[model samples]
Target chain A: MLEIKGLKAKVEGKEILHGIDLAVPAGEVHAIMGPNGSGKSTLGYVLAGREGYEVTDGQALFKGRDILALEPEERAAAGLFLAFQYPVELPGVTNATFLKSALNAVRKARGEGELDAMQFLKRVRGIMKSLGMAEDMLKRGVNVGFSGGEKKRNEILQMAVLEPRLAVLDETDSGLDIDAMRIVADGVNALRGPGRAMLVITHYQRLLDYIVPDRVHVLMGGRIVRSGGPELARELEQKGYGSLPAAA
Target chain B: MARTAQTSRVTAPAPALAAQLARYAGLKDRLAGAGLPWLRDLREAAAQALAANGLPTPRTEAWRFTNLRPLHDLSFAEPVALVGSEAERAALALLPALGRWRAVLVDGRFRADLSELDGLPEGLAVQPLASALHAGAAGLDGLLGTLARPDQEPMAALNTALMEDGVIVRVAPGVKVAERLEVVSIASAPAERAIAFHPRLLVTLGADASLILVDTALGAGAAAYLNNPVAEVDLAPGASLDHVRVQDEGPAALHLATVYARVAERARYESFTLSLGARLARNEVHVTLAGADGDCSVHGAYLAHGQRHIDNTSIIRHAAPACRSRQVYKGVLKDQSHGVFQGKIEVDQIAQKTDGYQMNQAILLSPEAEVNSKPQLEIYADDVKCSHGATVGELDEAQLFYLRSRGVPAEEARAILVQAFFGDALEQVPDEGLREALSALIAGWWEREGGAG
Candidate 1:
């Protein structure tokens, strides 16, 4: 469902991702594990078409289309989702308003009818119930005063609501506790199906324990030096990334 | 040319002022209260002051951020009354009726036919200024120029000299009017002629009286006109006045309003202004808390785009002990539009234990969009607590991207974020209908204003 060929990228004139090749076939979940400053987050940002993440020399094709030419919103409308490391705080916009606008925009772009308030509230309430989120968050400003766990849960709620074909989770587990991780994992794991693809970027192996990936790739020195299955994460955890291949 | 020493402080006088004064030199004789001795004296004194002081210039400290060259560049004539014409009907049709007790002023002249004043309570009096002055409303002479004087402000002086017709609202003591009152001021000058009108809005609330007045102003003409209104409010002891002003002028007009409000012992005066229109506009409000335990709140939000300039200048005085005041002003500027907010809070030495707070914030949607905010606090009381702050910025980049990342278009995301900036300011309005009206104006500004070019 997603393919990156020589995915070289840079930020602020400093190259972060250099000559990387990765592929995630339809219906499979892939995990990109890396240590600090390993360009794991860079890959996610570049794929999502975020501004300032310069794609100097490479092509990232999602569902047979090179998305580098599309704007961030266009990429999103085309079923590309990036769960940000830090969700932004929108002071005046209610969570329900933000989520509704987003879902309707995506749906309308796909030639589907928009959901009315009643239909939206029903679906959102059901999802929030399963995610163990309070209903009052809907009336408050989007992420304005939310705790870390609530913000992440909101991201997951957005992912579940959008139901994108490909999802790029960037450091989604950074600030989450073990219990919160389990709930988020359950939500993400529930989204795993035959038509969906995910790229879980992480620095630790704890998150993978809940939502096991079909494939694991160790990204080091801006390059994916090793590729293996679920066992690779355990091996890397046992022997830290310092013991891996240093050749870029 | 008779220029005051104070007038010399105003840089080079604009030729438009000279031309305008020459054109209106004979207006005093044709004004509403022409034959009355006291009223005639008031107009004559104001006319002299208007000629001597002219208008404020950029050199003036209070007018530093806003240049009146645009106002001084164009000469304006008194608007021809369209009281009973098809044009008046069309203009009246455009005004949104907010409440049952409503008054419509078309080109500064009140239309009794269009107004609903049949069943007003005995103590509540709402009538046209022309009629009130003709019938000699009790104590009208003493209250007209008490708070706003001619030599003190040239704009108010001009208004006083050329003042034709407005509304007079007075509530008797111990009367609590539950229904809301509305005043809709519409400017409908001909497409070819530039018109100017000064309407005096005098409001008085007797002791223990309460009233809510919604004042809305707008313009509907292809040509530029000036709508200069001077409002004087007097609140008696234990009385309350919740005032809301919506300054939604047209693109081809100038709106300059001056409001002087005084609150007495244990009285409360709260006002909210939502300004969204006009090529150039300034709504200056001066509020004085005259007695102990008086509460005052002056909050507003302004949205400007294109080459428009909108300014909100205010001064709040705590004259008595234990009084409290709050001021919150927010503005959003796009394109090359300019916004200015100058707020001052003064606490007198006798006003011990006074509490005052003021905050002004602006969001510039365009790189070329500009904002000038000056929040001042002058406290002479040793036991008073007062604070003021100002901030200017663009919309948060991270916030914008986050909204867009969620599939909301860049423009829609921006509207959402900018509307958020006005949330708390809108919440300051207690009336739901008024708040909703203000919200619609805010949303309309975003919907139609072409992105900063």
Candidate 2:
């Protein structure tokens, strides 16, 4: 469902992602385990088509179409979602209102009927309840005062509502407690199905225990150094990424 | 010969304008015979002071931020007759009705027929100024110029000199009015040329009494009308008030307003001003905490689109010990619009434990948009907590990207962010319906403004 060829990205005239090539097929979960400053968030931002991240030289194809030229909203409408590592606080716009407007925007792009207030409320409340968020949070401003764990959970709730074709979770397990990690992993696990793909980026292997990935790739120095199965994650947890052989 | 004509034009004095000033000078003696003897001396002094200083020039420090080049050539006649037909009155009546007590001022004249004040509780007197003058009340003149300063703004002084009838509401001691007092001032030219009108209002709440005042202004046509309004509020010991001033004048109107308020011991004063109109408008609000343990909240929102210019200058003085004050003003300027906010908090040496916070934020929508913000704090007390912050910037690119990445359109995203920027000021409004309507009006203006460069 997603393909990348020598993805070289630069921010502020300095190259960050140098010659990164990766691919993920449908119905498969891939975990990109990397150290800090290994261009983990940069890959997620590049895939989500965020502004200011100049594509120096690369080709990113989603559903067999070049997506580097698309705007962020256009990429979102074409079924690409990026669960941010840190959610932005919008102090006046409510969570429910923001979600509904977003959903309607995507629906309109798909030529679908818009949801009214009641319908939208019902939809968001259901997802929010499953995510263990209070009903009052929907009325308050979006992530204005939410804690670190709650922010991540809110991102997951958005992912559930958007139901995009390709989901990229950037360090989603950074600030979660054990229980929240399990719940977030379960939410991602529930969305697993045919013709859908997910790319989970994390520094720890603990999240893989809940939503086991079909493949684990060791990333260091801006490139995937090694690719292996689920056992590779357990080995890394026992030892560390330092014990792995360096890629030539 | 051309040089001679040019010299004549430069040396020629505007005798007609001078005659207008002379006519204004003679009104004091006429007012002395009209009763209100205490007001006559102040009126005469104000007239004399204005004649000496003339009108304010752009070079003046107080008027430095606002240029009156457009109003320099404006030729205004004396107040015209109120010109709203039966249909016009009916059309205007359908607009938003303020709280319970409604006082209507049409074309600078007080309309008692359109107002309803049937059962004001005992000791609460809501009457016209002319009536108050006729009643020989000894307290009328003592409190008249106590709040509104004359020499501060030329327009304010002019309004004081040529003022007609206005509303007077006084709450008895220990009595609180359950409903808000709504003062609606509507301006209609009906005539071909432009004119000027001044409305003066005085509200006094006795010890332990409280009330809310909402001032709204509206006008029509491209008439060069000037709305120079002054509202004076007196809060006795332990009195509280929630005042909201909404100014939505016409595009061609020039509005200058002043709100002067004094808080007694343990009194609480909360004020919010919304300036959303006029080609050029300046609102000056002065609040003083005279007694101990007083609290004040001053909030404002100025939404100026097109070529409109809106300026708000506020001063909150903490004179007594152990008083608190807060001020927040936000502006959204689009097109070639301009906005200015100048706020200052002064704490005396004896005013210990004074807590004051002032913040001003402006969002410029276009490259041509401009905002000038100055938040000043003059504190002389050692045991005081005072801070002021000012920020001028475009919308957050990261926040915009986050919203758009969720499928929200670019326009809707910008509108939401702008509304959020204004949400703090809107939240201070006591009326929900008016708040929502103002939000809708902001959205409508954004839509009509198209894309912001």
Candidate 3:
């Protein structure tokens, strides 16, 4: 469902992601394990069409269409979601208002009728129930004073509400405790289906325990150096990235 | 006057002051309450003070960031009698109907035909300043031109010198007026000539009384004019007042307003000013906490586009022990518009345990757009706590990207963030109905100036 061929990007004249090729087919989950400054977050940002990231070469294709040329909002309407590692805190804007605006925008772009306040609230309440979030969180400002675990869970809650075809989870488990990780993992596991795909990017193999990936790829020096089955994560966890053989 | 100016080391009055003196010389005989000896003496004294100080210039310390050259160059003619026309009525109809008690003033004169004063509660008195002066109301003698000083505010002094007509609202002791009172001022000049008028408003809340006052300044035509208004408020012990002022004058008009309030023991005074239109506008509020345990808060939001200029200046004094005051003002400027915020908090020596806070924030949408913020705190008491801060910046790029990434368009995202920025100050409005009304007005302004740009 998502393809990246020879994708090269830079920020502020410094190349972060060198030539790279990766693909995650429909209904399959993939994990990209990379150390710090290995361009994992940069790839997520580039796919989401963030500014200041210059795409010097290659193209990102989503459903056989060039996704790189579209605006961020347009990409969102095309069923592509990027769950940020650090969610922004929008002061004075309630979480309910933000979610409603976002949901209605995507729905309107897809030529679907908008939902009234009551309908939207009903849907959000069910999502909040599964995510283990209190209803009061919806009334407060968007992540204004939310805890780290709450922020990460809020990102997943947004992912579930939007129900995108392809989701990119960028270091979602970095700052979460074990219990928070289990909750987030359960939230992600609930959305797994044959029509959707997810790319779980993480630094450690602990997150892969709960949400097992179909394939694991090790990213080093801005390029995927090795690809293998789920056992590869266990192998790397046992033998760190430094013990891996050099790429051919 | 010349000797006083020299001895006091004040700047010499500019030529604009001479012109204004000449103009008022012709209108003094026609001024309201002209036959009252006391009122005549008050006007004469205020005229002398205005002549001594002249119009504030950029060279003046208080007026450093705001240049009044445009006002100085324009020659203002005396305001002529104007009745409400169809267009004027249409403009009035567009105003938000947030209050039940409405008083309309046209060209600085009270429009009795357009006002609704019936069904007023007992112990409440509302009337035009002219009528009150004519009837020689019992308490009106000491309240008019008493709270706002002439030496510190030249524009207010000018207003007092040529005061024409305004409203007088009074609530008796222990009375609580549930309905919000709205005073609407509409400026419609006779022609393209620059006309000037001064409207004076007096509000008095007796001990334990509570009231809400909404002052709306708007215009009908594109004619050049000046709408200078002065409002004096006196809150007795344990009384509370909520004042909301909206200045949306015509594009070619200049609006200058000054509000003076004296809060007594245990009283609470809150004010919010929304400035959205006008060529050049300045809204100054001076509040003094004269009684112990009093509370005062002044918040404002201003939006200026094109070549507009808006200024919000406030001075809060904590004269009584254990009083608290807060000031928050925010502005958004686009194109070549300019915004200025100068706020000062003073804690007197005898005012122990005083608490004061002030904050000013601004967002400049264009490179050419400018903002000048100055926050000052003067505390003479060792036991007082006072803090002030000011910030000027562009919209957060990260916040914008986050909103856009969630499917909100760029324009919609900007509008949302801008509204949120102003929401901080708008939340200070004590009344929910009035707050929603002002929020709608701000949204309308953003749609016009911040859409697809």
lDDT of 1 by residue, B204-224 (tens): 999999999989887766578
- In model 2, the Cα lDDT at residue B417 comes to 91
Residue A90 displacement in candidate 1 (angstroms): 1.1
Taken over the whole model, the C-alpha lDDT of each candidate is 0.88, 0.82, 0.90
Question: Per-residue lDDT tens digits of candidate 3, residues B204-307?
Answer: 99999999999999988887788999999999999999999999999988898999999999999999999998999999999999999999999999999999
Docking class of 3: medium
- The parts of candidate 2 lying over 4 Å away from their true place are A218-228, A231-248, B1-23, B26-37, B85-94, B116-123, B130-139, B189-191, B430-453
Task: Please give the distance, in angstroms, between residue A89's alpha carbon in candidate 1 and its true position after superposition.
Answer: 1.2
RMSD (Å) of each candidate, 1 decimal: 2.6, 3.7, 2.8
> Which model, 1 or 2, shows the larger DockQ?
1
RMSD of 2: 3.7
Interface RMSD of 2: 0.8
Superior by TM-score: candidate 1 or candidate 2? 1
Best of the two (2, 3) by lDDT: 3
Candidate DockQ scores, in order: 0.79, 0.73, 0.79
Candidates sorted on TM-score, descending: 3, 1, 2
Query: In candidate 3, which residue ranges exceed 4 Å CA deviation?
Result: A245-248, B1-15, B189-191
